[model samples]
Target: MPINADYKYIAAEIEFQKAETGAQKMKALRNMLSTAPTHKGAERLRADIKRRIAQLKDEIVKTKKQGKGRSFAIKREGAAQIVFIGLPNSGKSTLLSKLSSKKIKVADYEFTTTKPEVASIKFENIWLQAIEVPAVHEGYAEHKQGRQFLAIVRSADFVVVVVKEFRDIAKIQAELKKANILLRKTKEMIRFEQHMPHMVITWKDFNKKNLVRELWKAQHKIRVQTRAGHKIAPKPIVLQEGATVETVAKTIHKDMIRKFRFAKVRGPSAAFKDQQVGLEHVLKDTDIVEVFMK
Candidate 1:
């Protein structure tokens, strides 16, 4: 059959995959797999895409479940989950041994960690929960054993993939690709825009000026969109005449909201001009603030 339309659809699907998130990516991948050309050359690619879509769907479901249970799991007296992933004999047990008091079996063989093990680590006032998962082999996902093991890895909030220097780099890359996970080398600062939603931009180094510049530009764009009567869903900057710092922090992240100690306000509001005030202080419009936490 003629495949020009199918090719176009596949190209669109690739673009959608780059831009969409969660459920949207899954939907686009499914559409592409279903509509791909049936020629022999396209068949393999279609199958690969279908497999990826299925994997992404599984991840989405797993992530949703994790989200629902995260608070309960973390607040269970003292608990936090850090999942370790790596190939066989990758020093997972050694690391776990050093971090926590849990006695996990350490062996110089494959599949040593057949079952998940949880351990508790204390650092100052912070308590962390660590989970060591089984070693995933090459092409493990294609088999039943590997699939079941990976489901555990997918539920982790923080994933640690262990690799040795002597191992084949290609093999490690392949495993990561199959697992649909990437190692983040550096942390990125969270940016909140006026009209646009929040964004994460990777940076090589910390440059406060550059960061503020980007935020300012995003705020300008939001103002323009708002003035044009467009709906903007960016983080809300609410400023009532007598709004407390607690209320403002509540509108942000809830975890540190209650721990707010003081706020330094800026912008057009003169009452809070260069003044540090407690959580009970009321706020005004155009007030930029830096909240201090305990």
Candidate 2:
């Protein structure tokens, strides 16, 4: 049976997915646990939430004990956060510098990058934040710094596994798996097909543009432009796929949801010019929404 989750639970889930820090994730998870349905069918869901909450608490404690004023946290920016992860000497920094157009230090030695290096890469009309995390190795999840690094990966919207050879992909994947980071192929985004469960792109065919496109598609998001009168907003509001008119209203203003009267739509989602839609109406990319308040 379906969980039939309510709006509060769904909103909490969105917050959890976008949370950048352990504290933020903890808050979202707590909200999810509180708002989740208290039905027999949802017992497993509740248990899973409780288990994750406990795990996060332990991780937070371990991180605090390990760090004495050091932090691995990178502030998320732009449309999305794409993390570049791999084993040592995997050319992660090379890809990061090329894509972001930033002068990042590139070296031949192992573990050259000791910390997280971040920059922004534009994808057509929007820009995305890209981060090259310190390399992963065997028993990485057990190490103090490695734990912090994996935390960053967990918060990323998309992950690109960089490697010098195709075989090295397995090594990186194994290390990431130890940290509970799962990688899956998004066939819809790119045409490359691999035997592994993770999305592994060939280094020969991979370039700055391809990386940007893959990140955009893997994010599973849509850009919606909210309109006022005859003028539309200069920047579109980024939201997850399947976002509805109610979702847009809440994003614009919390009160907009409560005081919602109706909304007028145009662009891709609308069936007719300036069509009237209710809160449940799903929005599409480039859709223009004009919300009316009671």
Candidate 3:
């Protein structure tokens, strides 16, 4: 306390006492510093206030750094990572549970999920990672952990905007736009374009099967099964759209490209059954191929 401190200084002291978070304490300490006494007698007191303010600032910075590291840390698994964002109680948890069969905390109240909840969503022979992020609100980008959360969203392979009402989509979009995350779609299909992540707005049609189908479509990837004689591999090789035999060979092993002679196709991309095609042949979804080496 400064000697002959006025009401403003006293008010700041009260605010400091009531502050709950480091950021709040920093604000109150700043006010205290401004109204602090400037006389020789109060020099020591002012120095102490300055020291406290500096310490608070350092702590806040350190806490934000640690938070960013922890909050945005998500290990990408499966074929792709898709994150779901919406306002609180917007069926995000329900959708996650239905799609992934993972039990998530579902409540009628708000902010039930304060952090990211992740699960694996299987689409036929392929799997995708789904994460439910905390609700987005106005000024979300300015919130303490909002930036970190948005960073995680931005790094996702795709984003699904879950909303309770159709109009609420704009609110989530606004928050995402604040972080430069733009939503792109083609017809009813949305996908990643340029450097931006792909996104889809869904308020209805929470069907698990359809959702998985759309998610796989948006990724623009195809599943190709390899065949050796009459036996076909159980797990299919997932590849991007417009992928060719060369691409598939390269995916199996880099050395296959050099030793490759030709591939026998059996499904969608095949002109005829067991069609012999060169490495430049384009493949399609669910195409069964068998590479024959010279």
Off by over 4 Å in 2: 1-70, 182-198
lDDT of residue 155 for candidate 1? 53
Residue pairs with clashing backbones, model 2:
none
User: Candidate 1, residue 56: CA error in Å?
Assistant: 32
Write model 3 residue lDDT over 1-294, tens digit each, in one string: 332555465446645764667877889889988887888877887898899988988988888888754546877667778988889888888888988979999998988998889999999887898998899988999886888898888788788877767788778778877887766667654444444455545646766787689888888789888776666767677788999999877765445677777899989898899999999999999998887765
Position 195, candidate 1: lDDT? 15
Q: Give the C-alpha miss distance for residue 87 in model 2, angstroms.
A: 2.0
Candidate 2 residue 39 C-alpha distance from true site, Å: 47
Please, what are the lDDT tens digits per residue for candidate 2 over residues 1-294?
122555566557656766778889999999989988898878988898899999999999998998756487577767887778888887778878878879889888998998888888988767899888888889888888888988887777767777778888777767767777655546443211221222455568576777678678777788887776666666677899999999987775465677788999998889998899999999987798887766
Model 1 RMSD, rounded to 1 decimal: 20.7
In angstroms, the error of model 3 at 215 is 1.8
Return the TM-score for candidate 1, rounded to 2 decimals: 0.40
Better of 1 and 2 by lDDT: 2
Which of the numbered candidates is closest to the native, going by highest TM-score? Answer: 3
Question: How much lDDT does candidate 3 score?
Answer: 0.78
Off by over 4 Å in 1: 1-79, 166-170, 184-294
- Give all candidate RMSDs, comma-separated: 20.7, 10.5, 22.3
Q: Which residue pairs in candidate 1 collide?
A: none
